[model samples]
Target: MGKEFIELFEQWADHYDETVTGHDLEYKEVFRHYEAILAEVAKRTFGHVIEFGPGTGNLTEELLKRGRTVTAFEPSPAMRNLAQEKIGNRAEIKEGDFLSFEFKKSVQSIVSSYAFHHLTDKEKAEAIAAYGNILESGGKIVFADTMYESVEAYKQAIKDASEKGFHNLAEDLEREYYTTIPILKEMLEANHFTVSFEKMNDFVWIMEALKK
Candidate 1:
């Protein structure tokens, strides 16, 4: 499933900006909310930031604007190319999966938006462990992604999509793996992260955890 999503994203890379720009008003609002979160993270950790799953450099550009050194990682080749074009020498864009990517150096912060939920539950747990291993002490991990109110809510979302003629579209879209805030908090805490969350509207949630 991860490989399939990578392929789909590669095909969508060329038209990603156009397809997303103002196409979904709700999603656009989500991005704006994400930008605000990025600003806060930038002010708190202004050096040596690493961003995972920077599909097309949207948030990467924002981090660079704040004068932070950014390492942007995206798995899809086409998406990485587009990000490199947009960011140029200001940012280092690399092609690698966040779940498996390694860095020789530690970073002051790691940020991801609308991307981490694609990982399986085990993968998500592993990612938190990886972040713990790579992050400098007192560094932060800020992430925004889909969060379900309950297990039933997730099931309803799946049912709603199927009934609205979106089953196929949803299937083709990135598969989301969601967990409640408590579950996420437990995972982060187990990994030695102090976690907090802010619900941004109904569809998205922003979580910030500082390494202790």
Candidate 2:
């Protein structure tokens, strides 16, 4: 399922920007919010950072802007091209999926945005485990993604997307599986991550987990 989704993203990467205008604002805010989060996380750990599933280098650009070295792993070729064109010589962009990608050295920080919900429940659990394996002791992972405040809110998002002709939006809503703060905390905790969650907005949830 994860592989198939990665393939779909590869196919959609070229048209992704046009397909989702909301991503522009979401990406921008991700950077602004991430700065503070990264600072707090970095204060406790040190090493090269790896960003999983960086789409088009939005967060990568901001991470570089803050004077942090990052290795961005993106599975989509089109996204990698766009990120390379956007980032230039700023950061190392690797073309690969987060679930299976290997690292030569342990990283201090592992971050992701708006990509985790694309994974199945099983894959999400596996990815969290993999992150634990790759992160050095005391390292952190900060992730931001959609979380439903209520089932009604999830329904409304689907309805809104339906009105916009994106009938498949419901599939993107992972509320049925892992959309609430508790679920996210439980998953991270099960993987030996000390979790803290902040509700950023009606739909977005920011999670910071330190390996303990």
Candidate 3:
């Protein structure tokens, strides 16, 4: 799972909201239109939802406002604490990760925002396959996170980040499991999902994959 970054997330627990709100210039672009992106994800989701990596419960809040039942899984204890503090008893914010979460009820939609990059491509595939097995026909997976259109675009993003003296951003781009559209499409399709993408920002794309 993404537990490897628990320490980092624990350290970032307090400042995470600040970074997402454009307080950190290096990551500003990465989190641009932060609220709107959460809103868009919430709008696309329906019925019972399982949210992976619900950091600080931002999207959880949106989903709750829409009157949707949400069960959020987060790996970091610190992040989970913050999310629980933010969401209260409205939604169950549990300690789990993308590939290691558990829920008894069948869900209509599986959603996430700005957190899927924690898994490598192989892990991503495994997670998708697992979801495919659980979800019935017409169930959906709505995720919004950093993704590139092509390998060249991925490289160019890192280059641009480097040239702009955004070493942290550049390093993060190079370090994370951020992947390309083609690869994700193939993975989703192999798992019986009909996927579509919409660019949310220079660094983020909304992937809506409906299980067939």
**Which number leads on TM-score?**
3
Quote the lDDT for 34 in model 2. Answer: 46
Worst 10 residues of 1 by lDDT: 22-31
Q: Give Cα-based local distance difference scores for all models.
A: 0.76, 0.70, 0.92
Write down the TM-score of every candidate. 0.86, 0.77, 0.98
lDDT of 3 by residue, 30-142 (tens): 89999999999999988899999998889999999999999899998888999999989999998899999877667899999988999999999999998887676899999
In Å, residue 39's CA in model 1 sits off its true spot by 4.4
Q: Where does model 2 exceed 4 Å of error? A: 15-46, 149-156, 159-171, 174-178
Q: To one decimal, what is the Cα RMSD in angstroms of model 3 from the true structure?
A: 0.8
Better of 2 and 3 by TM-score: 3
Candidate 1 lDDT, 146-211, residue by residue in tens: 777677776776676566666543463335566777778888999999999877745567789999
Better of 1 and 2 by lDDT: 1
Full-model lDDT, candidate 2? 0.70
Model 3 stretches astray by more than 4 angstroms: none
Which candidate leads in lDDT? Answer: 3
